[model samples]
Target: LSPSTGHRSIRTSSKPRPAKPCDPKSPCCRRSLTIDLDQSNNALDFVIYPRQFDIGECIGSCDTSGSSLQYTQAKNDQQKNKPHAAYNLVFLHHHGRNNNSLAATRNHRADKESSRCCSFSRTGGLELTYTTTVNGPIIKKYIPNMTVESCRCGLPATIQQV
Candidate 1:
């Protein structure tokens, strides 16, 4: 496929686009990146099927301050009545309960060692037909974790290894 056929450029007017309202529930999410294997500048010799394909990527902020998309119902419920700063357990424990009396206590202590990032929580594979040379035979290969299946806000070190 030619460069133009592999990727298309969008023509826009001078007018600016209206700003989209910020969504409180929107946190780190997946967006697609178009891969053009047959592009003129692409030096890949493999003849990938579907010359142009979209491989999803993670985008957006990792700040979960007002975002519910990354949290579960149980987590949200815990946030409603948070624990005391000094105590590792909840206030109810002082009365007559155990540490587990409330939801699991979070280590609110900021991790200075590493910062959170928008990363892939899950990953999939892409099966494409490729050839060693221009006239070589087509071979189907499943590249492990070649595609982004899902995304989440987490430490870069905690990203799942394919």
Candidate 2:
């Protein structure tokens, strides 16, 4: 969230990271962000920020798609916004990756512009590919009693204490 006005995916022309051993399939684990959302109604509003703490490194630095981590970063090397590791999609999970049910959700402050979903709850979380660094304003549509599942590297799996 740098440049003061960063609300979308920003691309940069930086160099690629050199070949390193840390460069494996980047076999990462499942990292989840648990939020204390108490919506008495039937649904709740959710906001997922990129990185909430100093993940140090290797958090998103590896890939299993047979692709190497970018030599250069898409965003500035400011820890949170760093795109050394591609930011994957955030999935709206139910209990523990089962089917779904329930409401809708949205990213950022644009709630009115969000759409609705039925049957199951699955929202496309903030995904920053190698090309794009950070793209806020994601239309996260999910019901209540849900969580986020993202493919990430480093530290097995770290639950982001939101």
lDDT of 2 by residue, 63-146 (tens): 223232231231124245433222322222222244223432233133221211111112122322221124544542322212
Task: Give candidate 1's error at residue 119 in angstroms.
Answer: 0.7
The models' CA-based lDDT, in order, is 0.47, 0.28
- Runs of candidate 2 with Cα error greater than 4 angstroms are 1-26, 36-58, 63-78, 81-146, 150-162
**Model 1, position 100: C-alpha lDDT score:** 39
| Tens digits of lDDT, candidate 1, 24-120 | 6867666655566666455655657757655555555654464444334423443453321112112212422333332333422343212345555
TM, every model:
0.50, 0.21
Residue 127 lDDT, candidate 2, scale 0-100: 26
Off by over 4 Å in 1: 1-24, 64-114, 157-162
- Locate the minimum summed-lDDT window of 10 residues in model 2: 112-121
Model 1 gets an lDDT of 0.47
